[model samples]
Target: MDKQIGYGRWKAPADVMARAMARMRERERAGGPRKAVIGSGKEALAEAIRRYPNDPLRQLAMFLDASPLPALIGRAREVSAKTRTNHGDMLRGAIGDLKAINMKVQRLDQLNRRQVMALAAYWTHEKGQTPGTVANKLSALRKFFTQVGRQDVVPKREALYEALAVTGVSQQMVTRQQVALDTKAWTPKGVVPLEVIEEVRETYPHEALLMELMLAWGLRVSEALGLRPHSSDTPNFLLVHRETKGGRWRKVPYMKDAQKAAYQRDVLNRCRQWAEKSRRLEMGYPKLTLQQARSRLYNVMAEIGVTLEQRGVVCHGLRHEFAGDMFFDITRHRPPSENGADSDWYKQNKTLVADAYQQVSEALGHWRREISSAYLGSPTKMSKAQRERMEQSMQLIAGNPDVKQGLVAAGVEQFWITGPAADGVLLRAGEAMQVAGRFQEGWTAENLKQVHEVLRAGVARPIQFVVSLEAQPQGETLEIFLDR
Candidate 1:
């Protein structure tokens, strides 16, 4: 049968309001997030917005208070702490967007094709909302309509994307391999220089500190805001206090470089002073709730032009730059961008590569090293530098008479070099060192005595080795020999 309000399938707005109030009463027996339920819901809802017929935001708040879709939608009818994070705020944002274009939509049911298109443009151009954010906002719109018995008002996804494209937010055309591999690199998205932080510090000192922490430790915004000033700092490391995504706890170290370390100390000291003066060390966000704190910081960021829409960079990009900078600091190599070394480097220096990824992942508070690939890049192809190094070494070694003879005989040989400056030559020939085997003549008593010396420790480490052979084999032609 067709739906009927307060009968079957559909509950009147007042009926939902009463049910939610009753739930709150039972839960005081558990708490409340939503607007307070007043005497006879619909009447109170109407009165709150009767004066603001032009303000859609006020009207939506009234609608949410009276209807509260969760009361009808969820099996639990519970208002979670994450309600704002997931859906509530997103819905509000969509309605408020109408105000930007001066549409004056008093009722959400009045949300028309013109308003939806305008919102898409606002989010895309004015707000610079990411594609993921845009999708979530659209979802919130659908949910609002679905519960309010106005699903037909929601625009098709294709139409929404088309509207977004008008504002230059085109649909992402990703290939199957790209989707499966997930190798989008965000390195050096743009450097957040010290001057930007200082400029923000002049107005919003605390928000600037959060940005500083983000750049210094690769902290997510929530993690930075949720720090315990006293306990977070060990002598060398900063423990993520709380509010981690997925509750991940990580310890980021004060940098090894002297200047970086000093800067870290300075930041910590300032944070400590601020916490002591304004809030207890334990009260990371102080009197402000999570929503209030986020709104305040984001407003400040926008004012200071910290957004991608404003400064051509967003706060999250700090984490990307940090990942890139951290990888370089640890491995002395650039993090993968559009052009970076592929698995060939990892193939040979597996341990080295693993260690670098491990340290960076830990510092960034990500459990898996693979997740870092989104911020740092994963190169699908060989880099020019790596390819050049390998080809140059291969050409040089392959051209040699001894190397060619060894290759012809057994495909591999015990290769070594004894030259005037053998150390420098070996250092320069890093890629060649993999094939450069240790020279040991047959197991004669004299050759056996050479055992304990253990020339280049772990030569199967297929790397560099430095040693002196007993009897000088004349010239540098002593490149390839048998493994005997």
Candidate 2:
């Protein structure tokens, strides 16, 4: 029976949903072991059958009878598609003699996108799937789908690529690994100013230290919350070991003054409380879970005028900053972007960003050298002289009194012209917004709307302005550029 006779929705045949349910029920009638796992799996499988408009038996058989490699690969692919990590080995371990292929496909096809994405999230977040496991599964699935010749089974390759394209996966699996390697790195560092931490502290004193630790050390909120005085007794270092992402152990060495202070005082106190509550003094870490710490940190970071624009200032920014700082230190005296050439660390370490690429690789914990090498390339860096010239140009532009008055007088009107820098002054103007005559033609309402869209998407956070006011005299010559 054609499931999609009229409507697009697939309505399963009568036996499709009932097949698994019937089998489970028969097992129950025979006084089989009543296990929650079996029940849940059956229920889920049955539900999938009911939702999909296909023959379950035929699909399961098709999946089961294929050679071990293809079958293992196909199942692994399904797992990877459902979870964004690698689990080829686990998939192999879970594989059993295929008595039914048609049934498996029927059940799998019945699964909705939400179900698939959830399973994927759990696999990576809960089960700790490796990149290799994920890659093999993806490879297996690609082969299975290509061989199967089902339009529905053939996934959106682009989306699959996006989901599986971890830093190194592209290099090994995809044909355009080199091209992908050429792209700029998006390390997990934020660009929050050092002063912003002090400002946030003045407003919310309690969270000030926490904010500083996150920005300075790049410790995840959970790790920060679970900090301990006893475990972190080192004068210049704090030891961190937390179970996140499937109970994996990640140890971070902390070396910031703010972090050291927090460890001695507030953080140590919290750890004692947690230890008492859990009735375990063996591990003297704070009891606060990562989720709790992350939430509080998010709110605090937001209040401190932190935006995504400063790429190395967010919670994850600390690690990126650490890596970047090391990179700068290693290559400071040498000319820029010479990762592949002879240098101090490269000379001694016998490593090049283009060759061994050890710095970024070790920082990122990537398994492959190719993954770390991706960070070695940078097309955005300007020459030192060019950078100085750009700074001078900005100063020259900033020095013009008319430009300043125009920016200030226009207030909010000038905001769309210059983004957040003009926001504070514009807000003060309120209804008295007055844009300069020069902007009368350029700063149209349509243009402002477009600018807002660009600002919102480009910055990855809300806008903030540092406004300034100054005195200006009449008959001041205004030199306005057409670009403005």
lDDT of 1 by residue, 1-484 (tens): 5322222222335455445446534533322222232222345345546756767677766666666444322123444557634676887767666776787666544676666666766776787777677666766775566554455454554765665566565665100111112112233333335778888888877778888778787888788777755556656677674776544456688776677778878887777666665544533467888778778778777888876665666777777666667777776676655233446675677677677777887788665676566665554422433345344444444444543444334323244443312222212222334333433444344332333223232132233333335444444423543432
On residues 1-484, what C-alpha lDDT tens digit does candidate 2 reach at each position?
A: 5332111122334454345346434532433112221222333334435654475444433343332221221011122233422333333322221112121233444433333333333444445576454445445444333333322332445765555343223323432232111112122121343555567767865465554445444444555555443433333434343422222222233323445445444544444344444333322224545566567667766766464543323545444444444454454422123222233444454443343345444334333454433344332232332234334333433445554444434422332223211221111111222222223343455544544443344332244322212222122222224224
lDDT for model 2? 0.37
Residue 291 displacement in candidate 2 (angstroms): 2.2
lDDT of 1: 0.56
| Each model's lDDT | 0.56, 0.37
Off by over 4 Å in 1: 1-192, 282-285, 338-347, 381-484
Clash total of candidate 1: 1
TM-score of each: 0.43, 0.37
**How many residue pairs clash in model 2?**
38
